[model samples]
Target: MDQPEGLTAVGEEQKVCRLQRSIYGLKQASQSWNTHFDEVIRGYNFIKNDYDPCIYKKISGSSVAYLVLYVDDILLIGNDVKMLADIKAWLSTQFSMKDMGEASYILGTKIYRDRSRRMLGLTQSSYIKKVLKRFKMALKTRSHSHEAWD
Candidate 1:
């Protein structure tokens, strides 16, 4: 999220439009988008977290649903099993949303959570395998280091 070109308000007393490809951040784009999404979700009865603006919560009697937004990515949590599906439907009506369930691989790391054992794990085993195969080292001896060039 490096500063975008001409991103500063620059005391123009007005706003300007941007017409360039940015590094995932479009200056006020994130905030405006977030505000828009927050309004939509709140209209659907979800409450935005004051402490953590990225988190939105909804409570219905004993049931609760939580939403976490990271830029364009959203991870939802809820005690009700159908909450995710319901939210997905609602969000789809407002904006395009793709539900990535269970979060297996992100940024080359596979995430696993053991609910009964109360543990979580992040491993690059699949990533490493892909890297190995990419280098045509399928049968090469394994060394647990990326700095090994020889």
Candidate 2:
């Protein structure tokens, strides 16, 4: 932590301070947090996905579970309910985790599932609208929206 303004001893003005551990406000803190999370999650026998380091998976017998992380939030999914619950409980013990129940959205995409058909879908319609609105280019009609594609 740098000395607070007006509180630093006269000679200390030229000196910089170093932190022993990363914290939220530091520039490198997010990297440190991700590294720590990876270590802890890997310790639970999960393997980090090669394509996406933020994703981890665990397998036991025929059951497979996935842990998707976006910063501090997590999305836990699996075919076995008991196994998912166990992983959630274990994660709570390792960190200050909160169970957010089932995930409905991720990365501004809506998630849809049909258990009977074993199908899953993701949509970003709402996200697109938000982006359009932010840029003051939101179309007033579906026709206008489609015309932009041409």
Candidate 3:
């Protein structure tokens, strides 16, 4: 297929995504997905955040919902999960997605969410511990919220 101006033709983009735009430096590929995702969800009453439009919100009474996407991976957070599910289904129908429900790992960190408490937490404890052990810092017997390192 002939390559789109902003996108590399198939078999051309092998990890070296084309240089297309710049904020301070090159960063443009996300524009298409962001535009499409925003257009589709907004059609379903999902309003993209004004300050950070990439962050979308859907509200109904006491139910505040969220659907966030980075490139193709989606992370949903909400009190009324059913609405989120519906949003996901709608997005899938429009975008042809691979939905991996419930985020556990992202950006090299493990996420643990307790629905009952509605608390979200992220940690690289295993990773840090491995590093410390590699440098023999694990023997120090000091355990803090990873803040100790910082």
lDDT of 1 by residue, 13-104 (tens): 36556546555566788788888988888999998889999899989888899988888888777888777778888888899767767877
The CA lDDT at 135 in model 1 is 91
lDDT of 3: 0.75
Off by over 4 Å in 2: 1-24, 142-150
In model 3, how large is the Cα lDDT of residue 98?
85
Instruction: Please say which candidate is ahead in lDDT: 1 or 2.
Output: 2
Clashes of 2: 0
Q: Could you tell me the TM-score of candidate 2?
A: 0.73
* Ranking according to lDDT, highest score first: 2, 1, 3
lDDT of 2 by residue, 1-150 (tens): 787787878867977667665443778878988999999999999999999999999999999999989988999988899999999999999998778788898889999999899899999999999999999999776786567788
Error of 2 at 143 (Å): 3.3
Q: Write the per-residue lDDT of candidate 3 for residues 1-150, one digit (tens) a residue.
A: 344577775666654534444433435557865777778788888888878765788898998888776766777888876877877787778887787767889767899989699688999988898888999878665457766687
For model 3, name the residue pairs that clash. none
